[model samples]
Target chain A: MLYIKIADLKIRIENKYNYVRALCKDYIIDECEDYDISVSVSDKEIDDEISVAEVAVSRGYAEGVCVYRNICYQLPVKFNSYLLHSALIEYEGKGYAFAAKSGTGKSTHIAIWQRVFGDKVRIINGDKPIVRYLDGEFIAYGTPWCGKEGFAVNDSVPLRALCFIERSPTNSIERIPASDAVLRVFQQILTPRDAATLDALFPLLDKTLMQVPCYLLKCNMDDEAATVAYNGMNNDN
Target chain B: MKIKSGFVVREVAGQTIVVALGEATKIFNGMIRLNETGRIIWDMLSVGSEKADIVRRITEEYDIDEKTVQADVDAFINTLQGANILE
Candidate 1:
């Protein structure tokens, strides 16, 4: 059993492999007697993950994935937390999430922001981040299951903006209505498998969308793209 | 025809999203975003409303003509049928 804290929730994970522990080493704590959640995966669950994985994954990797999947599945119903598939960056003390389909250059775009803004940017989580609505505001937390780049921190920042990125020849961005943002945002979240969780998620999802400003960004791989995105999202109303 | 079981609808930020759960997930792994008219039609279908009844309800709600409403409802129903959402 590995005890870890993420998104302000202490979790106990029972795993069969050391790889799960190694992957989650950053978030691991010495011990927790009363964890908020406990997750354990069956052999069938691990095998199911292996079968559906895009590339060939080891049993250990599959186990780790299954554990995270279980965590994501329970977050919304058990807690007001949800997983978002995006590259999260903290800039000027606020978190900005860049979400897109796989291979959509979300990482590349955030890298441009890093170069353009220099030390002003920090990558919170390169791939998946746990977002929790706490104290009337959404906060993005770094998790161990970050993407291939392996960039993540066991820290969090208040979420300020959510951007849906698209590849384009010229750089452009616009603030989109929540109604327009819902479908796009849906594409970047883990849909709960059961009806009860799905039902419980709608109001939280709506509240998050209503609280956060969402943008549709079309840009090329240019430093100017980062500037445009920053200015568009950070504009003083 | 009626909407299949295990299909849930929820309104988020003024947009209606339909998602599949449980056994329905095997057939529809994605969500369907519905506009106002689509939501009306979907609600009617959920109650097992007939085609003429749906058309009448839509016509009573909107300022559109009967022929336009009929065509719109048919197109929406056909979309639902194509997605295997209605049974």
Candidate 2:
């Protein structure tokens, strides 16, 4: 049994699998005993303990390779948070996320940011990060199952911008309209198909979008692309 | 026809968004963004308002002619029907 904090939420997890435990080693905290949510992951057939949606997402996204990832998606909704399929990075002490389809080079774009900023930029999570509206601001946090690169830290940063990246001949960034931004952001999140859950989820999403500025970043895999994005977003607001 | 049971029209940052909820989300595909007039019509549709009632209300609210309001309402209703959002 281990207690850890992700997305500013305290959780205690009991796991029999070493792989799952190792994935969350960086997040383990010894000081906390009470948890808002507790998760147990095992191969044992515990029929009543699992959700149908959890099993569906396990097969759909992680392909059942990691039970832990499935839980990461499920638990956030209970706290009015959502897990987004994006690479979250901390730049200049603010959180910026890159979102796109699977093959849209989100990770590659992050690499370019690292190349440009070097020591100044830190990768919060390479893959999925949970986001929630907190105290009149949106915050992005790192989770254990970051991505294939396994780049994640148990940290939280105030979200500044969310960029939907696209490959293009020339580097450009534009502020998307709220309608367009809502659709794009909604598609990138792991949402449960339950009315009560969605009722809670949509308001959180709406507040996040209302607070955070979303951009459509069209760029290629080049160092110039990084500079272009940084300049454009900084000047946008 | 009535609007689907699980669809909610929410206004965020001055933009109106029609979102599908629960099992409706699986088949409703994506959300639709509407202008101020669209939001007004959606509100009426949700309450089982008919096409004639919508056209009458829009003509009364806006300075537009009855023919124009009817055309706009018809187009909007068609879009909702095409998306399979109306019952």
Candidate 3:
């Protein structure tokens, strides 16, 4: 039995199998005398290719949301662990959002900022972070989808900046205008709806874009590049 | 189908917002913005001019080192068409 804890989620898988499928009420869950939090796949979903298993685990007030693909991940992560979906790292903090796609090195950039800011920049969560307009202020928190890095922390902080990164051949940065950055910001946001919330989300996105200052950060993969980007943001304040 | 007019460009939050570029007034689902050159081509088209004359005016006003202003016109119109910014 392997159990991994991601953000506020505790994920455990039992019984070695080739594939992982979503769990439903009809699926069979059992208790092992040797292993606790053991979940087994019912014979039905194992054969169905399209089926998905969603396990609900809770930690403190934070709820666990998980989607599993293979049985290889039955073992738990060493650090605040979360499973990975794709080659991506997304986290959230307070009202401001900092999003970068896979190659953009989202974690590396944030890590550099964290070192510079020290305690001022709290990494509320790592991996897949959730953002919402709570109490009239936007809040970003960590989700369980954190990757193998296992740096998921249970914390929340006020967002101050939004950054978009690109792999550049040169070691220079460009400050983009809000209008030019808004299109990119809208494209990076992760939101879902059931026909009722999409319209609302766009406006929320628009309002958020209008308020935040976003930058186009072009840099190489080096410590100096991170310092340059962080200091540029710090100087504006 | 409407005849193309002139477009007015403005900057909002660092983005160049293009509206009513010349009188054509296309109800575009997606908006379009012209850089330095797009504005120049748009100016000649606004006065109910022909394509050939517009190209002549563009070649004279801009230092663009390219052959066939005709190709540029075709490409620009195609982009506008694809963006639904033209009738």
Pick by lDDT: 1 or 2, better one = 1
Ranking by TM-score: 1, 2, 3
TM-score, prediction 3: 0.47
Q: Per-residue CA lDDT of candidate 1, range A94-142, in tens?
A: 9999999999999999999999999789999999999999889999999
Model 2 residue B45 distance off true place after TM-score fit, in angstroms: 2.4
What is the C-alpha lDDT profile of model 3 across A1-237, one tens digit per residue? Answer: 344432223445553432222221222234334332345554444434323323332221011122333321331222211122211222233333446666577667667656654555555444555444445654444543455465544544444566677777665656667667756754454321111223344445555556556667787766666667666655676
Best by lDDT: 1
Cα lDDT tens digits, model 3, B1-87, are 222433444443454445442233434322455666666666555555677776777787775544667798878767766655444
Q: Highest TM-score: give the candidate number.
A: 1
Better of 2 and 3 by lDDT: 2
Local lDDT at A104 for model 2? 87
lDDT of 2 by residue, A1-237 (tens): 667777777777665545555667787777575677776645533332334434443322332234445455455467768888899999999899999988889999999999999978999999888887777778888888787787888888889998999899889999887667877887787654555656677777777777788899999998999999899789956
The reply for model 1, stretches above 4 Å from the true place, is none
Off by over 4 Å in 2: A14-19, A30-33, A40-80, A133-137, A175-180, A192-207, B63-75
TM-score of each: 0.95, 0.76, 0.47
TM-score of chain A of 1: 0.98
Report per-prediction Cα RMSD to one decimal.
1.5, 4.7, 13.0
lDDT of 2 by residue, B1-87 (tens): 889887877665566777776778866856678887898899999999888988998898888999999888989999889888888
lDDT of 1 at B18: 89
Task: Please list the residue runs of candidate 3 whose C-alpha ends up more than 4 Å from where it truly belongs after superposition.
Answer: A1-97, A111-122, A191-195, B1-87
Ranking by DockQ: 1, 2, 3
